[model samples]
Target: MLETIYTENAPKPIGPYAQAIKVGEFVYPAGQIGADPATGQLVEGSIKEQAKQALLNLSAVLEEAGSSLDQVVKTTCYLSTMENFQEFNEAFGEQFAGHEPARTCFAVQELPLKALCEIEVVAVVKK
Candidate 1:
């Protein structure tokens, strides 16, 4: 059975989708922007700040789904500008730390809320 994941610690989905969905041992987290859950506002700052918030948002979703960044097997990242790639990588790298997941990143024309970056993840949860 598939289960939807939700948490107050993460920003609510702005669209008609769950924050994450668990099926068997895997959890698929939706793409997260840099919106703060408490304020429901896009975090305002540099690309680094935005990337941090985005990772925090992803963390909350993974936690809610009974997984974590360490359990994450793969990730897809979207950036509004490739020029921010190094900055975004710096922030993202810190979050993942020693557990590096398979990842693909690309520059997009834009993201929801006009944010600098967004990330989606897939993780393995303890059964």
Candidate 2:
């Protein structure tokens, strides 16, 4: 059976989609942007700042799904510009320090709410 995941710690979906979906032992979290859950506003500042918030949001959704960043087996990151790659990488490295998962990042033309960064993940539910 599939389970939908939701958490107040993360920004609510702006469209027709759940925060995440879990089936069997894996959970797939939708892309998380830099918007703050409390304000539903995109955070201001550098790409690193936005990347951090996006990761935090992704983490919250995973936690709500009985998973965690450490349990993530894969990640897909989107950046508005390649110029921010280094700074974004710095923030991402800080978050996944010891347990880096397989990842793919793309420099997209844009993202929802004009966020500088967005991240999504697939993780194994902790037993």
The lDDT leader among the candidates is 2
Model 2 earns a TM-score of 0.97
**Among these predicted structures, which one has the highest TM-score?**
2
For model 1, the stretches where C-alpha displacement exceeds 4 angstroms are none
Encode model 1's per-residue lDDT on 7-105: one tens digit a residue: 999998899999999999999999999899998789989989988898899898888888888899999999999999999989999989888999999
In terms of lDDT, model 1 sits at 0.91
TM-score of 1: 0.97
RMSD of each: 0.9, 0.7
Pairs in steric clash, model 2: none
Report the Cα lDDT for residue 70, model 2.
Answer: 93
Assess every candidate by TM-score.
0.97, 0.97
